[model samples]
Target chain A: MNSMKGKPMNHKKFEQMILTPEALTSEEREELARHIATCESCRKLSLQWQKASRMLNKPLPMAAPAPGFSARFAHSIEKRKEAEQQKQVRRFITILLVSLLSAALIFAVTYYSTNSLETIIKDTANASAQMLFLWESLKAIISTVTGFLPTVLLIPFLLTAASAMLTLTLLWLVSIWKLTLQKETVL
Target chain B: MEHELQQWLDEAMQGKEESFCRLVDHYQNGVYNLCYRMLGNRHEAEDAAQESFWRAYRNLHRYDPSRSFQTWLLSIASHYCIDQQRKRRMTLIAIDEPFEETFGSNSPTPEHVYSNNEQSSQMEELINTLKPTDRAALVLRYWHQMSEKEIADTLSLSVSAVKSRLFRARKELAEKMETRREEYELHERETYEPQKI
Candidate 1:
């Protein structure tokens, strides 16, 4: 019985080593083999591990999917694509309806606030004229500021700024295009 | 075959459905076997394998070509099965039920078939008892023949973690086998001990 129990420390060490025998060094394996010869429980543990490892590691035959698996997958993909198209159509219709509703609400508020169609029309004309005047004034201010710089510096600087803006816009558009493509492809 | 796989992958990435289906045909068995081992049933394995393929199709562009495509596909299946097992933990489903039909049936005799079924069923029971991540690690390591580093990459764990999980999983299986053996021995003793007279 005492022999069966073995030394507690050695038992724990051998037990862990048995659990992961691949990690064992040659000397450790020899030591463990000697220990197992005397220890009943460790011997049983080793045998069990060996049996389980054999069963687990053996290459069982690969299970094949049912026939026409690819055909079924293709059908499902078609269904999913159709569903996605329908979802996109629904979203577009929703957005268009919301925009129309928002425009009608704004018109209604303007009509109520002004109390007359003529007043509303006159207000719209005044707003447009004011925007045009502001634009002209902004152009004049830019010309005044640019009048101070030499033509050589101004030409290159303006060209550089324009090219930078163009690059940024291109980058933004490309990113949006890529994002839309990704959204369409994502499940 | 490698060149053909690469061609199919390129076409699939270009949104060719037929090409993607061809890729599916090539890998169905490998993916299905992984799913069957992880889920432990034919029906769920079928569904899981199909879903994994769908996911791979959707995310095909994100796949890095430098890595092995089989490894990538199996990684997707592993993650899907692990998620399924986690969700299944809440439900009281019997995962240890004997498989209704043997897969890849090429055994020559009834005895071989019966022995295969028994071993397969016992394996399923033992494997189902493991935690989902540990089970994935074990399946990838022993069944798929993935290296420890590959298993680590698949499960997104450290190699040491994979090592420990494999060790822990094997220890649990060994312990379970030991207990079952002892129970069988006890039953046999009770059954044939001269009626305790």
Candidate 2:
């Protein structure tokens, strides 16, 4: 506040002038001068701001880049560009090979198939069911043998199995959480 | 001079590598120094400066000729440095470490090491305490002498945002300087008091 006129000038406005005096118009400069001349607080603030501005303007000790920085930088850019082109070429080749292999596989499958699609699918399904049945019978036999053991031993075995499954599940959840965090950071 | 520079820019836009190299030679010092100030390290600054130029080259087509090219280039440098600071969290500057040990430590010329004044070094350390964006704003304004508008354009921010960041940074530095000054005064009084007794 200019105590003389009871008009307040914000310190920020005064600071802006100190930082960039060229920004002030002639009339604003006159106003600022009159305020500083009359307002003790504003006068002190102006001096402090001017000192801060001078400190900011002090010459910085700058170090140049290592010798041949530009040449090395250009070389790195060229190397990166070349690497990108090579990556593209590799990608194209992989796509072409995958397409060709798929086409060949389709051709072979169609040429070899004398049965209808429905019959083939049905036969495959039946084979899978028979294998599942065999796996179930093997599990039944193992259980029957383990069933012969004492109940006390069987309880511990079951408890161990449960704890192992729980550990595995927790580890899986942690790994998934880590992966999601990594993906978020990358994005 | 700007007309001649524009001619080079036109050639560079047309894929004239030599013309682009000329641009690199012309502005490398400023770009490197900006990166150095922003990152507070030499090797990273060099890396950032180089990456900025490469990005500028790749995106030269998107550059608006109506804007200043130097500002555009510096914008790239500051943005890259800001991201690097974010990822690396480079808040601590190992200034006292020897130059060979640290990528951009103050070089150990006997004169530079022995003759270093406390105030400027303190100022440098205080600047490192700022957030990456605020530090970049201060560097662009004070070191590069960029106008507020230029800083705003370079950082892709509004002018008021740039001003606020500058104000916040300066406020923080001033507070630190005040504390340091008080500490020095206290030390001086203690030493003189013992001698007087």
Candidate 3:
């Protein structure tokens, strides 16, 4: 059926309106009623929707779990808690073993690579001298940098810069940790 | 009652097992109903409901207090059932097969057959034919009386998507029900033809 404006009433639009007639504007509903009054197909669809809507309104039978459901659920919760605890213990043990093995591997590689105690002592002395030279260079560089700025201003600036750098570093590390954890979960 | 549930939720969050159990006792039926409707079977529904609860318990910290807890639980159940349905479709089961299969060749008893035929309404049977997401949308919309926005939130779809799917689901269901009604009438006439003679 065509509306008074001569446009055919689309079945799809009418079906949608039948499903949710309350959504229709009053004018659209009046037009729909006029069309349904004349259109046999749309009227049949409208009745079918009414029956379907009634079917939807009927009470659905509620299904309950078998007896002992709550008890079984509580038991499952307990089992989960135990499993999580066991997992934590296993993780701690694994971490401890890994740390000890890593320390042993480092010690073995260091002791075997160095020739003897005398060589080890010589290497330690050379390392200490290098550190002392590095400290002297750092002191010289600091004196040079202080030439243009007051010590008070320089200290606060360095502290602020250090804090900002630390914060950025922490944030980067956190992001990487989160990314890796996410990857593990996805895998 | 909602405030009571919120109080129980708070206690459960505090590691009180009894409070959690009370919450379970209260919402178990709702969760089970959603699962059974989505899965169309009892055993799978039970497993899915249990799994949903387990997941919810483990991820309780992620539950936002501002939203409805029932919706959160139903979302988990719907997602699990939808995933299972996807896996089930991957295996390619025939549409005409009985809802459940036992190991033996024994046929279903007469009582089982009758009850099975009677329990599934034409609407629900037609609904079972829909895609998992669409089925979830219709169930949440009609059975649960959820608004379109809530259905969208639960199904992780947009509101317009939910509206469109609901419209499509109802249309499809109406078409299927009409076909079934005609088939039933034809069968009745065929059975009555011999008696008429």
Query: Highest lDDT: which candidate?
Result: 1
Question: Can you write out model 2's per-residue Cα lDDT over A65-160, one digit (the tens) per residue?
Answer: 777776876677778787776686677557655755665465446433544566457646764786588569757865985878786577556545
* Count of clashes in candidate 3: 0
TM-score of chain B taken alone, candidate 1 = 0.84
TM-score result, candidate 1: 0.67
Q: Candidate 3's residue-wise lDDT over B131-196, tens digit each?
A: 889898988887688999999889889999998998888777766667877886788799898999
Instruction: Write the residue-wise lDDT of candidate 1 on B102-160 in tens digits.
Output: 34545548787677666766676778788888888888877678899999888878999
List the DockQ of the predictions in order. Answer: 0.34, 0.14, 0.21
TM-score winner between 1 and 2, please give it. 1
RMSD of each: 14.9, 17.6, 16.0
**C-alpha-based local distance difference test score of model 1:** 0.77
| All candidates in order of lDDT, best leading | 1, 3, 2
Model 1 DockQ vs. reference: 0.34
- Pairing residues by index, what is the TM-score of model 3? 0.63
Pairs that collide in candidate 2 are none
Regions of candidate 3 where Cα sits further than 4 Å from its true position: A1-9, A38-41, A81-187, B90-120, B185-197
In angstroms, the error of model 3 at A51 is 2.2
Kindly list the per-residue Cα lDDT of model 2 for residues B40-77, writing each as its tens digit: 67778888888999998889999999999999999999
Lowest summed lDDT across 10 adjacent residues in model 3 chain A is found at A169-178
lDDT of 1 at A20: 86
Q: Rank the candidates by TM-score, best first.
A: 1, 3, 2
Clashes per candidate (backbone, < 3 Å):
0, 0, 0
Model 1 stretches astray by more than 4 angstroms:
A1-13, A37-41, A86-187, B90-106, B181-197
